[model samples]
Target: MEKITPKVDIAFKKIFGVEENKDLLIDLINATVAPEDQVVEVTILNPYNPKSFSNDKLSILDIKAVGQTGKRFNIEIQITDESDYDKRALYYWAKLYTEQLKVSQNYATLNKAIGIHILNFISITDSKKYHNVFHITEKESGLPYFTDLELHTIELSKFSKD
Candidate 1:
């Protein structure tokens, strides 16, 4: 593995985008935001490296931002046509939520985590609109659920402003 120095400044803006979504993101993570709760800072973790040196050389133009709400979010810009999209989304969501627990903190102290994947691939089925949210729950009772920890996936290819 070649050692690449992380250019923390320009890379951060490129991934997160200097747009209104930055503000909207703060609201999204906090669930509801007050008018005065200005988004003070945005931190991107080290694992958020855009470069992936796997089989295919590709960069994820995605943003992993943490806001004042103590919530972490993974937003990805994906353009791929594939099956089992729902399962793939779940995998990423779980990976983010579970990885938050530190050795000292318990589940109660873990901050709310979410993985938002926005894809621009055309759907194979009749389903047109693209936003999906997922949460942890039981199969049988289906009673216990965490309202804070959530996941959202949007298919941009099938979206319409109208």
Candidate 2:
């Protein structure tokens, strides 16, 4: 049998975005977040359904989910290396974070948005680690200034199967 590698968006969505495999998704979320911020449950907002990808134009298979708490999680897997991937991840985070505010809803009511990007190619050359987390911070103090927006990149190419 040919194994479906997560480098392909369909396989990643099938494994992590579907409702039936939510436990797996929760585990991933928990691993991504801090220990104190770990979630016990996760609700897949956009579950992977084969019918959902029937059209060629609808090929962007990104996963959207909510934690037991109010945090919103956006996950996507990219096979090719895009030099502008950082900007793309930030754009996704902003989109998800802004979408949480409904009509007449308070700005404080917006939930924390987290974007997880799994790439088959390397983007961060400075870091040897496969996983790297980024947050808005003061350049001088190097302290986080924004906690609501968080982005994580998992470079599959940097990871060794061993």
Each candidate structure's TM-score, on Cα atoms with residue i matched to residue i, is 0.60, 0.86
The worst-scoring run of ten residues by lDDT in candidate 2 lies at 49-58
Number of the top candidate by TM-score? 2
lDDT of 1: 0.57
lDDT of 2 by residue, 38-151 (tens): 788887774332232456222233898888778988888898887798887886777677767768988988878888888888899999999999888999998987889889
Model 2 segments beyond 4 Å from truth? 47-61
- Estimate, for each residue in 93-133, the C-alpha lDDT of model 1 and write its tens digit: 55566666668887786776677666667543456557766
Candidate 1, residue 57: Cα displacement in angstroms equals: 16
Off by over 4 Å in 1: 1-41, 48-61, 122-127, 137-144
Prediction RMSDs, each to the true structure: 8.5, 4.7
TM-score of 2: 0.86
